[model samples]
Target: MSEFNTTAFQPSLFILTGLRRLAGSRLWLGLLLSLMYIITMVGNCTVIHLVRKERSLQEPQYLFLSMLAWADIVLSVSTLLSVLKVYILGLYEIAFDSCLTQMFFIHTSSSVGSGILLAMAFNHFVAISKPLQYTTILTSSRVTRMGLAALLRAVALMTPLPILLKRLPFCKGRTLSYSYCLHPNVMKLACGQVRINILYGLVLVLFSFGVDSLLIAISYVLIFQAVLGIASREGQMKALNTCLSHIFTVFIYYGPLLAITVMHRISIRSSPVAHAVLGNVYLFMPPMLNPIVYSLKTKQIRTALRKSCKIQRS
Candidate 1:
C-alpha cells in the first residue's frame, strides 16, 4: 500500500480472485465452464472447417468468418487452463510471467475479433452496395491481408502493456479481480508510476473497440441506404437477411463487453458476483453462439453441413 516503495520488485506469483463467493460450488462451476469450453471449440472449429472445405463458402464474408472463428478459438484457449486451474484444481496461484503472457494473448485475440467484425461490416457493405464488383474487390489475397493486419495491429498495441507493468514495482498485494489477468486489473497491483499505464490502456480501448464500433455503424448505415434503394420489397428483404447472423454475432460479442467495461469503471460499489457472471458471459457467449447463429440463419452453411453429414454416412 506504500506509494513511496520505489524499490522495483516483481512478485513471484499473482493470486486469482475467481468467484470467491461460490467457493462451495467450484465443482459445478468448473463443470459448466468445461462444457462451455468444449462447445466453443467445436462450434468455431466446425465453422473454420466448413469454410475451408466448401467451394460454395469461398466468398469474402465466410473467409472473414473463419478468421473470427480462429480468433475466438485463441481467446478461449488462452483462458482455459487458468480458468480450469481456479475452478477445478482449486489453484489460484499463477506465475507472474505466465500471467503476463496470458493477458497478452487474451487482449490481442479480443482486439483481433473486433477488427474482424469491422472487416465483416465492410464486406457486407461492399456486397450489398456493389454486388457486381464484390468478388473483384475482396479477392482472396485481400481477405488474408485484412486478417493479418488485424493480428499485427493487436500485437503492436498490446505488446507494450505487459512491458510497462514489468517496469513498475507491484507493492500492492498481487491478487487479480478476475479469473484471468487483464491489463487494467494487473496494472492496479503496481505501486510505482502507473499513470502511463492507465492512460495507455484507455487509449488502447478507445482506439480498438471505440473506433471499430463506430466504423461498423457507418458501414451499416451505408448498407441500409443501399438496401433502401432496391427496386422491389423482396430484394430489400433478401439483402437485409444476409446480415442477420453477423448482426447477432456483433451484439453477443460487444454488448457484454461494453457492459463489463462500464462496470469496471464504477466497480467500487459493484458486487463481485455480478462481475464474475458478466465477465464469463463476455468471454464465453460469443464463441459458443456464433456458429449456431450462422448455421441457423445462413442457408448455405446449413445446406453444406447437411451435405457433409450425408456424405459421411455414405
Candidate 2:
C-alpha cells in the first residue's frame, strides 16, 4: 500500500498544535492528563466495585450503572494512551493503521457509553412509571441481554467508520491538531472529497448520541410527570432525588458535545487549543464527575464506600 506524504500539506496555523507549542511545554499537558487519568480510573473503579459488592444495588439500574463505569474506564484509558503517545513519547505523527485503530475504540466506547445511558433511562422509566411491572420488565436476563445488545450495537455502528476513513486518500495534512484521531480531525486529511464520511458520521451521531439523548429526555419527562402526580411532597422529593445524579451526568456528557458540534459547524477559525480542551472535557468530564455526582447524591453509595474502606483496612 502506498502511503501519502503529508509534510507539505501541513497546516501553517493548526490551532491545536500551535497552542501546545506555545502553552509552556508538553510536560505540563502530560502531567495534567496523567493526573486526570489517574483520578478517573480510581473514581470509576470505586463506583464499579461498590455497585458490584452491594447486594442491595444488584438490580438492573446498578447493572447499567456498572456498564457505564466500564465504558468510562475504556474511554479514559484509550484517551490517556493517545495523549501520552503524543505529548510524552513525542510521537505526534501516527501511522495510518494505528490511527484507524484508535479511532475505532474511541468511537466504540463513546457509542457504548451513550447506549448504556439509554438503558439506564429505561431502567428509571420502568422503576418510576411502571413500578408494578418494574421487576418483571427488567429481569436479570433482560439486563444482560440489553447490555449485550448495547455492546453489539456500538461495535456494529462504528465498524464501518474506520474502514471508510482508511479508504480516503490522505493527500492533504496528516498532522491531526488534536491529541487523538477524532473523526473530524481525520476527515480533514482527505485529499478527495469526504462527503461520504461526513454523512455517515452524521447518521451515526444521530442514531447513537442524538437518539439516545432524546430517549433519555423522554424518560425523564415521563418520570417527572409521575413524580408530579404523587400527592405527597415527600414522594415527589424522593423521586426527584433518585434522578438528580443521572441528570447531572447527562448534562456533563451532552453540554460539551453540543458545544463541539456547534463550534465545528459555525466557527471557521476555531483554535485547536479550544477544540482540544473541549474534546478533553467532552470525553473525561462526565467520567470524572459521575462518581462525584453519585457519591454526593446517594447516601447508599457513600455508606458502601466507607464500609468497603473499613474492610480494606482490616
TM-score for each of the candidates: 0.96, 0.91
Estimate, for each residue in 1-314, the C-alpha lDDT of model 2 and write its tens digit: 24544444433322124136556678887777778788889998998999889997788877888898898898887767667776677666565666678778888988888898889888877887888999999999999999889899999999998788666666565566677777777787777557988888889888889999999998988898988888999988887888888888888888988888777767859887788788778876888888878888878888888999999999
lDDT of 1 by residue, 146-187 (tens): 999999999999999888988788878988878898887788
TM-score of 2: 0.91
Which 10-residue window in model 2 sums to the lowest lDDT?
A: 10-19
Candidate 1 RMSD to the real structure: 1.8
Candidate 2, residue 18: how far the Cα is off, in Å: 8.7
**Model 2, position 74: C-alpha lDDT score:** 87
Q: Give the alpha-carbon lDDT of every model.
A: 0.90, 0.79
Error of 1 at 165 (Å): 0.9
> Each candidate's root-mean-square deviation in Å?
1.8, 3.5
Candidate 2, superposed: residue stretches over 4 Å from native: 1-19
Would you give me the overall lDDT of model 2? 0.79
Residue pairs whose backbone atoms clash in candidate 1: none
